[model samples]
Target: MLKFFRSIRQRLFKQKKFKNYILYAIGEILLVMIGILLALQVNNWNEHRKSKGTLKSTLKTISSDLKRDTIRAGYLIEIIELNQENSKAVIDRKVTIENFTTYPRTRSLVTIYQPFDIQTKGYDILKRISEQQENEKDSLFADLTQFYSLFIPNIQKSNERLEKVVIGNLEEFQEFPWFVDWSQGNTTEEMIAYFAISEDYRKKVAAYNVLAYGNHLQLIKGYKENAKHVLERIEKRLEED
Candidate 1:
């Protein structure tokens, strides 16, 4: 192609058609510039396509992370409910010392008071997203921020309260040794002796209520909101595709 154009130019130049030759040369230069522009546009399109794929993968990761958080929230809710039930039983004196004459189901109340462990998966994804340069305009980011701001601090606070409730005055109670001592099968007996009184057991149960239960509920609510937003974003991206 280049040789063919050069041959035409040589013929024109030999005929001394300088004006037409210059016009042809200018047109040739224009064509080359246009080709370069088109090549650059295609390159840009490929880059944009790659970036979109990366963004979609990130969104999928975030979706999975949110689901994990939802599961954690549900688990925490379960623990809270169980704690509430046992605390009420111990506090109301529903389980009597006579109940201990039999195998007291109430004795395992202290053992059931498990705390929620902070889930870091969602937090890690969020941090990664923040560090990246892409997807700055996505509304999902706003939803994520709102969700984390709502629950993260509260969850942290609840964890602190759980530590306090489980540890504070734990050594002062005579049953603490038995509770901590898992070596003996008589652990249930120790629990029964300690919680037979309504006052102390109820207070610890109340602490669970004050700290974990409400926070778990709040976290679940936030997770749902975030999940909903994420689903919407996914749908929108699919539609755009």
Candidate 2:
């Protein structure tokens, strides 16, 4: 094409048709400009397609991560509820202190400090994508950031506080005979009598268990809701594609 245009320009110039040659020159310049513009438009389209593909992939990963979180949260919530019920039974005398060592239900009350495992790798990838594409300030991105950075961390902190309280109370009460074996200290009857005598310690255990139970419930609710919202948004975005 360049050779064809060059041959025309040479012919026009050799024929001393300066007026036609100038007009042809301007026409050639316009054609070249049009070709450059078309190339640029195609490049922009390619880039946009690539970016959209990346976003879709990122959203898929985030959805999977959120799904895992919801499942784990559900399991933890069940455990928390069971722990609460067992502790309450012990406190209310439904499950007597005499059964604390031998009974399975009563045994769970003493085992505290279970922590929730939150997955953050997906969120971290999203965060990095947001940083790299600073111009793309979408609402979904903002919600994702808040969920991972603020809401999730807040739930984790609450769990940490609950664990601390449980640990502190357990440390104070570990020397009690009920926590130890019959061979090491008092007999089962003697341990039951000790627990029966210490109403305050029993109440503390019950209170901490209840606190943890409530916190876990609230965290699970928030997490599930957030996960649902994020998944819906991702699906919607993918649909738009």
Candidate 3:
């Protein structure tokens, strides 16, 4: 193509058609510029499409993560609420052996600890992207940042406070002479009697309520609601996209 244009330019120059040659040269340059602009536009369109696809996929993954978190949060909330009630009963001296069958939650409430379960795999990837692009101001990005960084961490912190109490007490429980039947999962008579009238047992159960269970239960409940709200926000953002 260059050769063909060169031949035409030579013919025009030899014939002394300066005016026509200048016009043709200008037209050729314009065509090249237009072609380059069109190619750049297409490349940009492809990049935009690829970016949108990645964003959609990541949001979906985060949505799934939120669902898993909410489900686990629901279960934990139930146990914690039971713990709250059981703790109260023990502190009030209402957990007698005869009534022990009715309030069997003391054993588990003191011995078992559930960690805060949250998934941040998708959020972590998206967060890095947001930071690299300086897109923290974007509403969706900000929402995600708050959910993962602030909300989730608070839940973890609260649960950890309670978990330390539950787990720390669990190891110490074995040292109790009355807890010999712990391995068998049987609520021994001595254990029931300790819970029934022991001031130390009441204090321990009160400490459980004050340290973590009482507040942690509410946090888990609120977290489940926030998780759902964030899930809704993600869906809305995806729809807008």
- Tens-place lDDT digits, model 1, residues 1-241: 9999999899999999999999999999999999999999999999888777766676666666666766776776665666667657666666666665443444544434354454556556666756875555766666666666666677676666666665654544544656555325465655566666657666765665555555645555566666666667766765776
Backbone clash pairs for candidate 3 read: none
TM-score against native, each model = 0.71, 0.80, 0.87
lDDT of 3: 0.79
Q: What is the lDDT of candidate 2?
A: 0.73
lDDT of 2 by residue, 1-241 (tens): 7899999999999999999999999998998899999999999999889888887788888888888988887887787777777667667766555555544444335446667667887777887778878634688878888778766777778878877786776676677656666325445675565454357657775677666766666777778877888888988987897
Ranking by TM-score: 3, 2, 1
Per-residue lDDT of 107 in model 3: 66
Clashing pairs in 1: none
For residue 136, what is the lDDT in candidate 3? 59
RMSD of each: 4.0, 3.5, 2.3
| TM value for model 2 | 0.80
Give the higher-lDDT candidate: 1 or 3: 3
